[model samples]
Target: MVPVLREAPELSLWLLRSPSPDSAAAARLAVRELDDAEVRRAALFVRPADRVQYLSAHIALRRILAATTGCPPESLRLGREPGPLLSPRTSRPVLRHPPVPVHFSLSHSHGLILIGTAASAVGVDVQRTPTIEAVRVVGPALHPAEWRELLALPEPWRPAAFAQLWTRKEAYLKGLGTGLVRRPAMDYLGLGTDADAPPGPPGWIVRDVLVGPHHAAAAALAVAVEPRITLRTLPVACLYDGDAGLPLSAAPLLALRRRGSWTLRWSLLERDPPG
Candidate 1:
């Protein structure tokens, strides 16, 4: 047995987190596990830009697994989806082999990076900080209730409007295992995802994260349960510096890079920040 290390029953979830995002070595390591070249051949479909992006994110997630179980990183593969939210080209050995019920998610906004892996439906979102003007412009595009809510905030507080909305959407998508291309929007009513959360989404649960100054983030539980997210802030220098792609792990989030790896120091904080 891999040992059930984490179980977030409330969210119907199990989580894994890693601080470093091993970008450089991930491609080489992951490919080695594949028995055929089709996985690599599939890479041709993904634009070079997107191909590289997916690889970096996958490697980071693999390393998170390695750190915990002492398993090989690339040995864990990315799931191939032919659906609308077709993911970046990568390996999926873990699903076939030893059956590691682990699934992963990746999100990046500005330079901050976030990745998540869980046994249940998981979602995450990261947004670059917005300006008050930008929030004003985006408010109309948002749901009517969100529009009124944000519009009512003071000028300086407006910047946070988009950030909060973006994070919630991102987190919701991550939980669904579908990227933003699916067009999922945020529910104005806050769900009590973190016990202290304001009434938001009724069916789903969400929590905002402050991993970096210029970043706003959120994560969600799937349709199964109303999740309560416990925030984890790892010592990912990339988060603070906005240059390094340093990853975060713990509670299902990991950071991987193709180059130098990071052994992150993260924290699990219970917070109820008033929105």
Candidate 2:
């Protein structure tokens, strides 16, 4: 079901478990909501699992945007040209469009999809907790200070700590729309006593979100004031049931006959004042 935001939420997050593609009809239904470009991108995936993840994330993104903007799911156009922006405020899908002022980010990992939206530029990322080997390989390349603090953690806790830092940095970069093109090592997010604190950078707020026991997620927003973030899980059944057009009050009833359930998680990080 689509979550109803009382006001423009400082940040709104939606999470959905990816659906299996074994049901040919289900696979087709997922793609039907996507535009031609998205369809082509989904088809480019060599593995069925990869394709399913891509389609599910995109479809979930559209539905979430549709619900908030009071538009049809198929009408919104999702793109990465300027970093995951949506367009054309209309109720029905169209081939042409005009720009709408909205900022969003999307990430998928291990059959889970996450979408974040806000009035200001926003970025979010999700990752499965990393292995020791994986952390060992990438740890040194992180901002020098952050790496040192990570290594200082107890052996068993380092992997998860590293994942948390990585997600924060990635979310910041995604929010900036520079992706990895901007060197992550150039920025210090914090370490040791400051691990939960906002990074050195100005004008951005980052927070760690608890997605599940096995996964880590973080969100970053480019805004002047400290903002509150709300998280909600929309049932995958809501989209397939053709309920995207339903009013917000009817959302709860749409949570029927779902093969999986959604778990909502939230985190709030206020910006650190200047020295």
Candidate 3:
């Protein structure tokens, strides 16, 4: 049996890289904990890559929540709630009958998945750097000031800049529960590099995350005061053992050991200055 968590952290973020094509059998075994609805949803994806990404993300989310809540991963009930205050039809993921006050969000893009858990509402997103054409196409849909800022950036820098802004915006919106259904252009999260965060939503802290050089990631939490953020990456091999992705206990230090070279390390990538 997988060890259960004695207490949930105030805030935490986990990053998992999707399995390579060669590890198909282990990847399939890793996601056996997903519920029937999740399995159906994953099957709906037309592309094989999309299906794998969905499977990888849901497995990680369930395993993490199971460890924290002491609930069987397959038995946990997850559902969508109406986002923010107004969008009645927008879907925001929430625990149906959580054993604790746990709020979480999940996002996956181009084989990278990010999951964030907190005592209060939290949202996270990861995205591959947008193409220059993508930036041009989506730029005008963002806040006017953000668009102008994108226009001002050097041609080569625009994709990264837009990606950072997009992740922050998505994270905040996801926390709000409104998502893009509420219109992303309504909020103005800026591109400034100073310590102070650019004016945007109130009562939430959004910050960029370092996930190596290929992807731009960010997480948002609804807190009056900023708390320390714990970031870690799980090697895909850990999932190869069983449906329990990380073999962890209630101890403060989260560790995973496999028979050979693969292991889990709770490394804090870097602490970015608080906004």
Leading candidate by lDDT = 3
Give the per-residue lDDT digits (tens) of candidate 2, residues 65-127. 776677777877654353333322211122134254567788888876778888777889999
Please list the residue runs of candidate 2 whose C-alpha ends up more than 4 Å from where it truly belongs after superposition.
Answer: 1-9, 23-28, 82-100, 192-199, 241-275
Which predicted model would earn the best TM-score? Answer: 3
For candidate 1, the TM-score is: 0.57
Model 3 per-residue lDDT tens digits across residues 1-275: 99874442356777777765446544454666778899899889987778877887787788789878999888899998876565566678998989888999999988888888998989898889989999999999988878888888799999998898899999888888888887878887886543433576788777777665668988888976655676656555444445453363322222222221223342533321110
List the candidate 1 regions with Cα displacement exceeding 4 Å: 1-56, 67-70, 82-98, 181-186, 189-203, 223-275
Give the runs in model 3 whose Cα sits over 4 Å from its true position: 1-9, 22-28, 85-89, 192-198, 241-275
- Cα misplacement distance, residue 141 of candidate 2 (Å): 0.7
TM-score for all models, in order of appearance: 0.57, 0.76, 0.81
RMSD of each: 10.3, 10.1, 8.5
Q: List the residue pairs that clash in candidate 3.
A: 83-177, 84-177
Weakest 10 consecutive residues of candidate 3 by summed lDDT: 253-262
User: Across residues 154-266, which tens digit of lDDT does each residue of candidate 1 receive?
Assistant: 77876765687777876775555455555533445332233333455555656555454566766665444434433333332222222244544423332221122322224
- In Å, residue 100's CA in model 1 sits off its true spot by 3.1
- Scored by Cα lDDT, where does model 3 land? 0.74
Candidate 3 positional error at 150, Å: 2.0
